[model samples]
Target: MSAFARSFLKKSLLAASTLLLGMPALAEEAASASLSNPFICRRPSGAAGTITEFPLPTEESSPTSITVGPDLNLWFTQTGTGTIGRMTRDGAVTEFPLPTEYSIPQKITPGFDGNLWFTQLGVNQVGRITPKGVVTEFPLPSAGSSPYGIAAGLDGNLWFTQVTGNRIGRITPAGVVTEFPLPTPEAQPTAIALGAGGKLWFTEVRGNKVGAIATDGTLTEYTVPTANAGPSSITLGWDGAMWFTEQFAGKIGRIGADGTITEYALPDANSGPVDITVGPDGALWFVELRGNRVGRITVSGALTEYDVPTAGSQPAGIVFAPPGFLCVDPHLWFTERGSNQLGRIRAVTVP
Candidate 1:
């Protein structure tokens, strides 16, 4: 078997053995990897089996956000097309028309009420779609506010950012939006996620800060140590901290519930880490957008980079698949913006 295939199998077997024995698993989940031990396979053959790319024919199209839909299909936004696209688990692709022109759809997420919610950046709107593809759009009160990132809040509301208006907006499942202005006007909040602590955590891209707003509208902000760090995306870390990516400073940052901030520099300068998510193995997994690679960092802050075989692939928006058999553990899925493809990594081993 090939080096990658063997490594994948080894990892899969290790995972299976641990599970069968009812022992606690400890290895960190990785999105991708290269073999360091020729005899020890690090990723399984079936895990890295095939990669598929889907192209949207719209002008200057790029995917902004992606999420698993209620139907188990992967749904994402096509910014340039003013449309949403869906990819089946078996690789079938379908596109749905948006309700407005120049919608510039940014982020797509599964809402509390089981609808697919997306941000319409250019048109200042939030959209929802049922499992059958019926779309409902809610217009933001502030024109040109540029609603960018979105997530389902703990209170069952859809929360998003106004990249231009410097505000956070909340929408009821019924499409009623109420805008909350951030303290620092024009801070340009980019992405948001719900914390385990029940607060909405987000990144202020232009303001260079990570902030949290309670479900009741109280806001707190934390400044990173590096200037112009450009905090872009935030997710709840398995280590019980909020982890965010510094798009400009090329670092990963951690913020505690009490507002303490720490930063970890990437091995490569200008790596431009963009999005992050909590892995099933309890590590933080992120996308190195400029480096065209997927990376994983343990709770202790150790960084490992995986080189993608395809150059300039631009990995973005990563997530771990729901648990399954040897063919599916630690499975990672991400977007390849430059190539317009969806990529997966399976049976990943840290060592």
Candidate 2:
């Protein structure tokens, strides 16, 4: 088997062994060996293979991106309500409204500073929220940057994308900010993730490419073979590759560290898969906004999809609880943008 397939094979076998033998499982869930492991595979414990949804307290809160916060609860962006929300697995929730009006926060990630940080796409800024629910907003130096995706970097900083500004942004914990211009103007860099070699990897939807940048501001870009693929969100796979969604192409694209790119077609031609995240079993899971389903795909390209209970809920982000959480009742939590609800696939249903 190819190295990519082997990566999936090892995790798949472990999942099966766990279900049948009732034994504990340990699977490495890191993208780059240089980075510390974030999440791990464990025997899933729950009632059954099912999905549950929790409605947001406010109307049209529009939960966008989700992450396992430092406190081991779920945190997400409420684009409509302009609030950052925290929710327990049991469906309890508390919201910290952003001070900025109509901020339209997009992607969120747990910061190394014991807080959650996110992008304010509408305001061209990044916002930080402490564990206690205090929020601080930091504006980008360049106006009209349209900051979108945000991820924590290995070097103790938060990195983000500028969909219109066409620049990659880095911000220190103290709120100091820096921007690097992409070689390809109008790349419309949408999402960012920490990838192999401690470089920050991101997707260029308009540029039809994926790119990586060293912490020192060195830049590199790789053209996706399929033109206008509209590569949206990106996540580092267990195979040491960067996997992303081709929103316009209706496919998933994997780019190796060497920049060799491969694309896999989803089962539905128009599923509109947007956000992706590494699951506990080492397989990648993503949200299909138009199809209203969550998809699980192995590194080898095999796929199994689970439908959302609410039709046209427009599931947005998918994230597994971090390793710090109690793994017994782990879940792959996601947001339902169209439904104003937070949802999750029971651990038992995940691969």
Best by lDDT: 2
- Give the range where candidate 2 is weakest over 10 consecutive residues by summed lDDT: 29-38
Q: List the residue pairs that clash in candidate 1.
A: 6-41, 7-41, 7-42, 7-43, 8-43, 8-44, 9-44
The lDDT per prediction is 0.76, 0.82
lDDT of 1 at 335: 74
Candidate 1 overall lDDT versus native: 0.76
What are the TM-scores, per candidate, against the unseen true structure? 0.82, 0.86
- lDDT string for model 2 (1-351, tens) is 335334433443444344334425434344342212224344433532268888889999999899977666789998888889998644579998888898888889887777889998888888999889988889889999999998888788899999999999999999999999999988899999999789999999999889999999999999998878899999988788999999888899899999999999988878999999877566788999999998888899988788999988999998864443212234678999999998878544434
TM-score of 2: 0.86
Show the colliding residue pairs in model 2: none
Error of 2 at 189 (Å): 0.3
Model 2 scores a C-alpha lDDT of 0.82
How many clashing pairs does model 1 include?
Answer: 7
Tens-digit lDDT track of model 1 for 140-196: 887889988999886878899999988999999887888889998779999999886
